[model samples]
Target: MQLSSTTSGKAGSNPMGEGAPIVYVVDDDISVREALEALIRESGWQPRVFGSAQEFLSHSRTATPSCLVLDVSLPDLNGLDLQQQLASTRNDMPIIFITGYGDVPMTVRAMKAGAIEFLTKPFGDEALLDTIRDAIQRSTTALGQEAELQLLQKRYASLSTREREVMALVVTGLMNKQVGGKLGISEITVKAHRGQVMRKMGATSLADLVNIAAKLGSSCGN
Candidate 1:
């Protein structure tokens, strides 16, 4: 069964992975690509097959959790180099590497670079399936964390400039009077702002609020 990647709007399109997860296979061998595509379809994931790394990179990837099944031997770009490039861009798609001429050094490089699985040719379907399942689980976890961080950032962004200053001071163990003195404001005003900060951040305790501030400050470089 030949799957047309352009049947929908996106290039090398699978169903959008927003609702369901996606699995992408990049193998030069047509038979291998087709076989994996069939397997992925049977598992109810959206699968997109690409013949080269460039093709895969050019595709517009959705923000949903996705796994990449890449052949180590590619014509234009080395699989390891592609992995490096993806990492450089902060793309966290889990990868499964497959190769017919796989070697020890190659395996080490791919694994060290964070490939979920390194599969040699003639690998069992069950082995590949299990690996894919693990990769998907990892991808889902990563996506969840990223989504949570984004939401936290949005809540932090909702803070007013003055409220942000108060938050930073309060998280640093400053008393209301100390915060008020630092900002040339009244202690009562500081108390009001602190209460607003707690409400806006949905923080129940000062320790939890401090943790949230730490996450923000870490991202903000102090």
Candidate 2:
């Protein structure tokens, strides 16, 4: 049951890039797992199947951005429980639930928990594929935002106390002379600190520095 051999729409397109954004299938049914693995591969995604939620959880890499095709009824951990566990850990991976017998209340619960889609058994291949594509796009965007936040945090961590003060003043639209006056430092000293702040923060322009500060939600001054 290889998905790569199937002829689906634009099977060559790997939207999330090669070997990234895998479609993880977690189901207790062996046949369902194999079938889904084939389907995902055929849609030009890397697929990994697990027979139980525990197996999936053990094998998952927390940092990797991926979408889950989870069965609502699992042997060890059910889909809802797994979703809650992932949420507790702040994992934002998008989930699409597949169930053999799901009612309106169950679907409502899944949707409220941030599931992208709730698919019943005998679901259409196209519907599942579309939902997975949407989920992948969202996951990619989220991962990129997280990466940017991490870089901002690292840059912010590199600034000295005085340099941080200078940065805050600069982003607050203060001139070097005004910043020096406020901090009781000479303009020459303020200029040096400004240069150091720019270099340490990897900001090419004052606007860039301001944007980074805004994204980090850090106060410009004490």
Candidate 3:
């Protein structure tokens, strides 16, 4: 299974396509980690192997957009514990679990906890590769969305108080004169604020500004 980069710089496009998605392989067994790393590299992904869960967690926070291939049983904290820790911190990294002695209930629990795949020991290479590809795709989509939302939030944060008020009124279908009247300001002042809002928000058009404002308003409500 060959994986290709599919990154785009658009607002909602994945940023991991410029290179192979980094795959973090966490396992206690040296052989298992080495084999998985070799397989990942052969499949066109960059692999980083960790001897245990603690080792993997010590890496600096990354925005490179990747997935994890973890062993269910580890020397220190188990894979499930690691998964819980990541989820608690709102990290959306996809995980694929490999276990030598997984039970039905354990598999169900892993799936319920948002694992992308669970493979028993001695699984075929094709199956493992397929699951990894799917997990990487999902992680890419999630990271892209997160990046876009952060960009939107940053743009919104750059607005002045009066500029934000003008933006809200303008997007809600108010004319400059009406907005000025509502805010007890001159129409010229409103025009100036609107221009500032547009420039700061990097809006290409009134409709784009309106869409962004609408998204912000809805998110705030939620």
Candidate 1 similarity to native, TM-score: 0.86
How far is 128's C-alpha from truth in model 3 (Å)? 1.5
Candidate 3 lDDT score relative to the true structure: 0.78
lDDT of 3 at 218: 60
Candidates, ranked, lDDT: 1, 2, 3
Task: Report the C-alpha lDDT of model 2 over 1-222, residue by residue, as the tens digit.
Answer: 223333222212344456566888888877777677778776777777787888887773646567899999999999999988887564457999999899999999889988989988888888889999999888888888989888878888888999988988899999999999999999999999999989988889999988988887844454
Off by over 4 Å in 3: 1-19, 88-92, 174-178, 214-222
lDDT of 1 by residue, 1-222 (tens): 223331222226565345777888888877778777777777878888888889888888678778999898898997888888888554558999998888899999999998988988888888888988898888888888778778778888888888888988898899999999999999999999999989988889999998877766664213
lDDT of each: 0.81, 0.81, 0.78
Model 1 gets an lDDT of: 0.81
Which residue ranges in model 1 land beyond 4 Å of their true spot?
A: 1-18, 220-222
Task: Point out the worst 10-residue segment of candidate 1 by lDDT.
Answer: 1-10
Better of 1 and 3 by TM-score: 1
Ranking by TM-score: 1, 2, 3
Taking all chains together, each candidate's TM-score versus the true structure is 0.86, 0.82, 0.78
Better of 2 and 3 by TM-score: 2
For model 2, what is the error of residue 122's alpha carbon versus the real structure, in angstroms, after optimal superposition? 1.6
